[model samples]
Structure formats: C-alpha cells, structure tokens
Target: MRLAALQEDEYALLESDCLFHLRLFEAAAMPVVEPVLQRCLVHSQRFKILNTEPDSRVLLETANRHVAIVDAVKSGDAAALETALSHHISTIVDFGPDVLPLNAKS
Candidate 1:
C-alpha cells in the first residue's frame, strides 16, 4: 500500500488496501462474510477513488492505522485485539453519514 501510494497508483493502493483487510476478515473464520466483504470493498472502491485528492496521504495514514492492529494481534491478547479492531473500524465510521451517501441519515 505504501509503495503504491508513493508511486501514486490509485488502483494498486486500493487493491492492496482491500486485500489486506480481506485477509483479516478471512482470519475471522467466517465464510459467509468473505464474499460480503469483498463486495463491500469493491463497491466502495470507486467512491474512495472519487473522494481522494492528489495531496491526500491515504497509504501513509492507512499504514499508521494498521500498526496498532498489527501490534495488538502480535500481543496475542483477545481484549487488546478486539479494542484494536474496534478502534480501527471506528476511524472509518468517524467519517459519519455525510461521507458515505448510502449511509446518510434521513
């Protein structure tokens, strides 16, 4: 992702980002969620691309976010892992409904 970001390759960065998360989703041992997640990630890909600005630091920011996840997973603590996952996801949710048109509140 970082390499793709540095190279300014949007497609590669998005692909790498999605693949990274897909592996984590697969790790959860839920077969049903894999396809669902793939669809969501792919569906959101275009919006993400559209929303990006040339100056945005997507990869660096994403990599920094992943550090907490990696550290938590490495610690082998379930509670810590859960917290890490929650916090990581919260970053996405923090954008609020405005950022995701489909999620907009009535």
Candidate 2:
C-alpha cells in the first residue's frame, strides 16, 4: 500500500507496531485493518530477531504476511481476522502498551 493512502494518524498508528495499529484501526471503524493486524501478529510469532537489530528473513516474512492479510481483508473475508487473532494472541499482547491501551480505549 502507498503511504499516501493512510492519514498521518493512521501511519503513526501503523509505525507503532501490531497491537497499536490493530486497536486504532478497530476504533476507527475500519474492519479491513483487522486482517493486516492479524498478519503482523502471525509474523511476530514466527520471528524473534527484532530485539537484536534487523534480519532480512524476518522482514521479508513479516512483509509477506502483511500483504497476504491485506489481500484477504480487501476481499471481504473477515473470518481471517478471527483466525489470526485466535492463533496469535500472545504476540498481540506482547506488543505491550499497544494492545493494553486498547482495552481502556474501547
């Protein structure tokens, strides 16, 4: 997706990581964002290298997951979001303040 498609607030939310973007997107009433967030959650589960600089494999895996989820959401398959959430709640919660704040925000 082009950076131009997202508002500054949306971009900031995205840059904040999986949980932040997920909660913000849900609060903003854009269900389409759920799948993308799910993909991020999944990617976070598969990789653990982020704490030690960057790795191309990790980045690529994450990006690929994001693209797949985005495509699924665009096609209106909301079930994918639930599937992702169920499978990766730990990763989602690990995003710390991002996911935690979602409870209060809601």
Candidate 3:
C-alpha cells in the first residue's frame, strides 16, 4: 500500500517506519537496536501520529529528521546522535497535538 494509505492505518503506520529502521539497523550489523527503537516508535504512535495527514511540512520534517538521526547513528557520532534525537523528540512533543485534530463522536 502507498504511504498515504498506510498512514491511515493506525496499526500499520508506525510499524512501517519501525520495520524500515529494523532493516537499516540489521544491514549495519546493529539488529539489537531494533527492539528498543521499535518499541518506542510503537508506543509513541499511539499518542503522536508521525504521518498525521495533509501536512506536507510535518511529513517533510519527519523524514529529514529521520535521515539525520540515521546518519548520526551510522557514523558513530554519539554527540550528534544525541542532539538529533533531542531535536526530533522536542519537535514531536511541541507539535504533535497540533497535528492531531479532535475526533468527533456519533
């Protein structure tokens, strides 16, 4: 399924990114990282939808941040990785609620 469609599937959306990270980590011979990252991603998705629809800027930012974080990890830059992760988490904490509209009940 396409990203837009997958983004709508609550169960699949975060899982998709987690799986991607898993593959990347595995290729880097760091498969052990997947479980922790996957767990965090899964838990975070429940409250913060990374692909919260219709916001191209949010999506772009998320993608860019992901790339930066991955690069930091790949390069074994502990300080850069920490900084990248801090910024990513701050963005999510600050903007996550703005992206998710209130659900209407019948």
Measured by lDDT, the strongest candidate is 1
Residue 46 miss distance in model 2 (angstroms): 18
Model 1 TM-score relative to the real fold: 0.73
What order do you get sorting by lDDT, best first?
1, 3, 2
| Each prediction's TM-score versus the true structure | 0.73, 0.38, 0.48
Model 2 spans with C-alpha error above 4 angstroms? 1-50, 92-106
Q: Per-residue lDDT for 1-106 in model 2, tens only?
A: 2231233233333344555446646855867777776787556544543442344444444444454445545676769865654454444335545555555875
Q: How far is 15's C-alpha from truth in model 3 (Å)?
A: 2.5
| Candidate 2 structure lDDT | 0.49
Task: Return the lDDT, model 1, position 33.
Answer: 74
- Comparison by TM-score, 1 against 2, better one: 1
Instruction: State residue 38's C-alpha deviation in candidate 1, in Å.
Output: 1.5
* Candidate 3 Cα misplacement greater than 4 A, ranges: 1-13, 20-40, 55-57, 95-106
**Order of all candidates by TM-score, from best down to worst?**
1, 3, 2
Better of 1 and 3 by lDDT: 1
Q: Please state the error at residue 68 of candidate 2 in Å.
A: 3.6
The models' CA-based lDDT, in order, is 0.74, 0.49, 0.61
Writing each residue's lDDT as its tens digit, candidate 1 over 1-106 gives 7777777777777788887888898899899778888787776766766776754376567556677777888888889889988987766633544565675756
For candidate 2, the TM-score is 0.38
